[model samples]
Target: MPCGGGESLEGDAAIYRQLLSISGHRPKVVLICARATELPCEEIAAALLALGAGKVETLTLGARTDGEKPAFLETVENADAVLLLARQPLRLSTLLGGTSLARLLRRRNAEGMPVAGSAAGAALLAEHMLAGGESGPTPRMGGVMLAPGLGLSNRIVIDQGGLLGDRLGRLLAALALNPFALGLGLDADTAAFIGPDNVLEVIGSGALTIVDPADIGHSNIADAAHNAPISMLNLRMHVLVHGARYDLDFRRPLG
Candidate 1:
């Protein structure tokens, strides 16, 4: 999967060319999002065409209803890889795959196809995700925690800046509640193209924020109420600026 660092036209075009090469020319590019109508998809399609993508297709997961059948995973299987647009909703369940996004993810994992997500797109790729919706102060969380993603990387992703306002604190708090994963906060227009070797390479023009809590002195989640401010916490974070690279092959601080 290719991650164009920024939203610049030139940058996206360049990445599209690289992606075309990576996928062996014949690639199926899947654009997943709820507000597909509002985005500049036509421009994106043209860019992909210039980059040598055999075909570019967009799937609207938000338009589907309970009675309608979801798009087939075979459609994705035939493509070189999938590209999930930022803000695309990805959800999953046991009885049935809730969304087309969820079904596609499951299919990719089963076949071991390369997958990539931007912002919310990236968040859904994680083992567990912070489900956003209408609710009280407490946000509900549920997804395939152990679901085998495209296996691009295992680091947990958090979308920040835009839709996720001041999400870092909440993410850190969540990590305190469940201390077994590394947190990556991707700013708007920023992306870390993670390879199978666990190497995170900054691609976009923005920054990739990493929160590793291995050395935190103390966390006050014991008595903290829901949505309450956390205290007495020590944490370290690294900002991977554009063009920089860090290896996640070994779970340690990015050196």
Candidate 2:
């Protein structure tokens, strides 16, 4: 979920409702804003409550319960659905990296719990986290920074502000550096809901861009020139609209 802001969750009501429904009636939804406390917790929690979340408890990483590891882990474990808020993915990764909360998220997802995120929160869900960097219309060397993420999904490099925000260039540059990775560029308001079967179902009103570098035959990223325009060949690009599904395991669009 790239743009699930205050006016945001309503747009993806179906998915929200479904995630909360997993608890049988009303579910316990935890909004972990440890990444950035500035996110609209009240608004987001209200939306979740409206969507049938039985209880919504927002836990900030460095706030009230910074030392309460067991309480934090227990809350996450008992929740039916957990949503990590947006903004400053690098900080989020750093904060959660020191705690068991991030690891618990991975374990919960493995056990079939609905762990979700929005915007920068969405980016950190990838194994290779896109921390943040310069963005332009053209690809450039050293435009992005890559860091280890929560390892929720290793298949794609989740990027925020896709075509709409002119960050595709950074994503291209990232893929060139890590050619083994796939660039999943998400525009504002759009989301790539990767299911248990490794099928990514596109959601929201915007589109998802898939940058595949598996067939790269050439590139000048080796120069590592600062702010220098990059040149690469044979990187596959796919723009998927709402409702389109891609098989992440096979790295192809589904018919």
Candidate 3:
């Protein structure tokens, strides 16, 4: 699930319940706030506990010693659910990259453990992450930057906290570069519960924007000058609200 950040706990109540259910009522949830060093883990942990998590453990990444790394990986490996909090995606990649914790998280996700990320957390879940870029107006060739992510999913590239920021251009630029990947722009308080089959069900008070460039007719992205505005034709976009669903494989909204 990709949350658009800001008061997401209340906005994502239904998703929280669903995640808890997936955990079989009570779950050992590990909250990783490695990217947001300024935020207090205790506060986030309290919120998760109040949301009905069976047990909550906060893991801070940067300060850990070599001796502490093993225990940290073990903690994550044993979790029934793992939540990546909102922050800068680049920081998450820097801290968790090549670490045992990253490897274990991937393994657990493959083993069916529920993993949810909000904002930057959501961006890191994709194989290619949108690190940073200008928002508002049309997309520009150099306006967006792409970086390696956690490799959770290659079919989709996510951009969160978008509606408020008018970051659709960022998502568009990402898809222009990687036409094979679907672009998802999650508004605040919104989420997409992507299933194993890559069918995403929308939930929350806001909307989820899906951008598919599979049939684009034209674009100057390949030859556009650095920082120049990009032009494209025949791009498809879908605006979905709560209870709506989309099929990534078919690149269309599901009825």
Instruction: Judging by lDDT against the true structure, name the best candidate.
Output: 3
Better of 1 and 3 by TM-score: 3
- Give the C-alpha lDDT of model 2: 0.77
- Model 2 ranges with Cα > 4 A deviation: 1-9, 12-15, 21-24, 63-68, 162-165
Global lDDT scores for all candidate models: 0.55, 0.77, 0.80
Task: Write one digit per residue (lDDT tens) for candidate 1, span 89-171.
Answer: 34322211354545656566456566766445566566555444322223223211223333233456454434233556556
Model 2, residue 55: displacement in angstroms? 1.8
TM-score of 2: 0.90
Residue-level lDDT of model 2, residues 1-255, one tens digit each, is 333332365666755665565555788888887634577778878887887778999878764345247988899989887888767787677777645677788898898887777768888888888888786767887788989887887778888754535787888878888889888887766767777898888876777889999899979887757889989898888999878999888889997
**Candidate 1: residue pairs that collide:** 5-203, 5-204, 6-204
* TM-score ranking, best first: 3, 2, 1
For candidate 3, the clash count comes to: 0
lDDT of candidate 1 at residue 91, scale 0 to 100: 38
Q: What TM-score, over all chains together, does every model reach? A: 0.73, 0.90, 0.93
For each of the candidates, the C-alpha root-mean-square deviation to the true structure, in angstroms, is 5.4, 2.4, 2.0
For 1-255, candidate 3 gives per-residue lDDT tens digits of 676664645666766676677776678998887734554467767777887888998877664242148778888888999888757888777777666777788888887887888768888888898888998758889989899887878999899855634788888888889988998898877778888788889878888888889998889998999988889789888899999999988888889
Deviating ranges (above 4 Å) for candidate 3: 63-68
Clashes of each: 3, 0, 0
